[model samples]
Target: MQQQTNYSNELSGKIALVTGGTKGAGKAIAERLKAAGATVVITARNKPDQADPDLYFVPADLSKRGAADSVAKATLERYGRLDILINNLGGSETPAGGFAALNDEHWESTISTNLLAPVRLDRAFLPQMLENGNGVIIHIASIQGRLPLYDATLPYAAAKAGLINYSKGLAKEVTSKGLRVLTVSPGWIKTENVKYFLERIARSSNSSIEEAQQSVIAALGGIPYGRPAEPEEVAELVGFLASPRAKYLSGSEFVIDGGTIPTI
Candidate 1:
């Protein structure tokens, strides 16, 4: 069982912008930030009917160029300043297949959503943050960057790998100036999408759900934890990274995978 820890409401005076905060890991991150007392604004392509009225929402398709600028403008307009930018939006929309199975469009879309989206948003927002002389940017990347599955996720893996590099470079560039840029790479997380994917695999292959799950795990080499992580677990890491408690921890990439990565 996981013990609940008080997050100190340390983010009391901060304002945060979390991309893709409607569901999954992004939603968890947004809620955690709110619990820590930050005024949060969220961006999404689709708005939910029961969206929290306390939180500001900006609608923009991040894969589209200039969307980030629009979101930044709206966030600043609503709050006048941004203290935290959480790049929590990404996925592999590519169809299943090896190298020859994917085309130019698939690659471009994957790269745009996974890598370019955050880069563009950061470009529009980070200048203001840097000028303010203090801020934190957290990029939510994936473990596929280091351990590529290669089948249908090559593009996503490659893009996340680029993001890791980009985050590192940006961190080094601005750390001395009092800005903190960090990356968090999560392993297989138990999201609704994954559950649906597994169900489809089970139905199509006429295999038990357990078997399909094991297959997914096998593809990852093996998960020592024996299962995927909860969205909240990933969110807790985001919370810590965004807190003042982690002040000296800029530019680091924290991998939260229950020892699954098999790396030092």
Candidate 2:
């Protein structure tokens, strides 16, 4: 049960860009920002399947070299300024196996999507934020960065680890400059893709979906909260962090993992 209220326009007069905003956590974040009263722009390799007239769409593959620059240019040309940037485009399509199963291309693509894409986009957009003297940049990392499931997402984990480190250093460099940089690392979130993956695992392992889910929990040493997080739950935290209420909060890694990592 959640309470409804007449929302304040906390993000009124602001502009936000969310990469891979067509689906999953990215979509939730984009919607949350819009509800907060920001003019939101979304970028993906293709336009969304459904029409969303409220959001401006930019089509670009963030893994490519100049895509970030093109997106930044278009956004600035249309809106003249950007106040928030959410780097939420990341995944591992690498085949499930250990290090020997991964080739150079696998490693390169994973690193490009998970780490370099955000770096390039941040570099492209940070100058304007610096000139304006205030902004927020969020890197959507994963618990895999710290507690890796090597049998499947080794490259993704390695890349996210790099992203976490890069985000921290960038935050330290820019917090004094009026731009707040932060990282949000989520655990197993209940998204469409995750549901489909669990189904596939259930079929392949000749197990029930419940068993398949448990297998994942066991692999992560267990999620004490008892289930995965909803994408909207992750989005809520992002919304607060992007708000003026979190003004003094920067250069931090916020983990929304339901106590999945056993250690402090």
Candidate 3:
């Protein structure tokens, strides 16, 4: 028989910070990093329903001005250094109804949350990471960046597209200076919130949850894999990318959309 490889300590001495880590894919990513032996720090607007003792939690709303600086200060004061940064706190609260329904406030708020927050956080932490001569920055973007749903998530898609472009530019500037920057764009993730969303769709359409899910998938031009991705699956990709195994990877957007994008 072959011997089993013990890969649990890949990030034994690394310290990672994940934004919006109280729930959904953010929580999953934080957990994954922790399981891989990194000291994980998570920040969100609210406390997690069930706390994990191993992970450090900081309450913050990144959309507010100066919030990024506060979070960076708190983390650095505690850990002294950051090895990995995951910019994952993003969402749109704007009402549906296409461009005409939106106003300056809607666009500004959406842009601030989805684009500016990450930029501010990155600025706050970059000095230390650059001084250390090593670090990894991963931006959690969305597939909507490229394939946007105009009726509901236009601003969000635009912001994520900006993030993707910014991530690439940052990578070009930092990759030679000992920092790695990458983007992960995922499509419909089947999280707890998404389950509720599906339920609502089911009720509204007078259909089963499965049918509602299929309808949503169909609206996305179909996920070739036949389902939305699980939070853990996306977490797994982030874990690998943040590990030594992907040392050669940088300045690229990794799409975990299950082929929802029709064109290459």
TM-scores for every candidate against the unseen true structure: 0.94, 0.94, 0.93
Q: Per-prediction RMSD in angstroms?
A: 3.1, 2.8, 2.2
lDDT of 2 at 187: 98
* Model 1 C-alpha lDDT per residue in residues 21-128, reported as the tens digit of each score: 888888888889999999998888998457797678888899999899899989888788899999999988676557987899999999999999999999998889
lDDT of 3 by residue, 1-264 (tens): 999867688999999999999899999999999999999999999999998999999999999999999999999999999999999998876655579978999999999999999999999999999999999999999999999877556899999999999999999999999999999999999887776766656765678988977777877899998778999999999999999999999999999988898889
- Which of the two candidates, 1 or 3, achieves a greater lDDT against the reference? 3
**True-vs-predicted CA distance for residue 67, candidate 3, Å:** 0.4
Report the Cα lDDT for residue 111, model 1.
96
Collision pairs in model 2: none
Instruction: Give me the overall lDDT of model 1.
Output: 0.89
Alpha-carbon lDDT of model 2: 0.92
Q: Give residue 40's error in model 1 in angstroms.
A: 0.5
- lDDT agreement of model 3 with the native: 0.92
Q: In candidate 2, residue 135 scores what lDDT?
A: 98
The residue pairs in collision within model 3 are none
Show how many residue pairs clash in every candidate, following the order shown.
0, 0, 0
